[model samples]
Target: MVRRAKLVNDAVELVPVLQLFSTETYRRVYETLLSEWRTLEELKQLYGEGVEEALRILKNAGMLEIKWRMPSDPAGKPEKEYHVSYTHLSINVYISLKELNTILNAIFMAEDEESEIVDRILEQIGRGRISVQHISRETGLDNLFIRALAKKSLKLNLKGQLVEPAKNEEV
Candidate 1:
């Protein structure tokens, strides 16, 4: 019987990437790929089960590139080695207006201190203020957290000396 391919929508694509922040296993697998290429076997040895699905998700999101392929055993089945396509994958996320609204709404609804900081950072960036140093000083949040939240949750891209939201090409 032929297996149907899983349909990936915007939310589905975002889940794996978002999980990198909260899930230890996903974070470890992603960080490992950041340093060097690894085969499925090697990833399995290190991350055990769920590594395959996690790699598939990242590959679908355009974060990982196949480095090479070689036979895993005498049967000669090809095992592809993979590595991060960019040093910074978060910058590659394509956030639609809908996704951006959803992210912002979540931040607004959450009572956490970090959420408030992120909201302030977004408000500052949306107003044509793109400097991380400026946002950090204004929001009183750490520079690293502001940068990470902007790149990861808000899908901002660092171009030259400025960080801005990933342009919605569909617009």
Candidate 2:
């Protein structure tokens, strides 16, 4: 007896939710839940032990909704499935110059091979408001990846004449 979770809120707080899944396994479990509702057994099988605990934490935080299903067979037991409740997750991040530098520093800490493109994108965006096409042309990065990362990771406001960091988000 699976049912769609009610979308009571349009968005949820992302940072605290992110904090809940600090470990890689917990993150993987949460990502799996985002894709689709799954039974505890299914999650446990897919993610190994401690998945039940992770699901419980997410459910308690209102990030997941659980529906119980009573078995049709006389001797069978009840089962539960979990679904992500919110349509969006919002993070009110105040990215100061120091924080931005920290992010850049962390990116720089990665292997040079992997950080080259990321470094270029950050450098281009740091210059001023720019179009994804312009950034792509300048950075030699794929436009789609640049666009998505700018909007998602960098929190760019893409609706205006020029792409810019979202207003009220200090950089």
Off by over 4 Å in 1: 1-16, 71-77, 89-101, 104-171
Q: How far is candidate 2 from the true structure (C-alpha RMSD, Å)?
A: 14.6
The top-ranked prediction according to TM-score is 1
Clashes per prediction?
A: 0, 0
lDDT of 2 by residue, 53-166 (tens): 576556535677778778899899978788666545444455456544433443333345444655566577788627778887887755544543333332344432245654
| Every model's TM-score | 0.43, 0.42
RMSD list, candidates in order: 14.4, 14.6
- Using lDDT as the measure, the top candidate is 1
For all candidates in order, the CA lDDT equals 0.60, 0.56
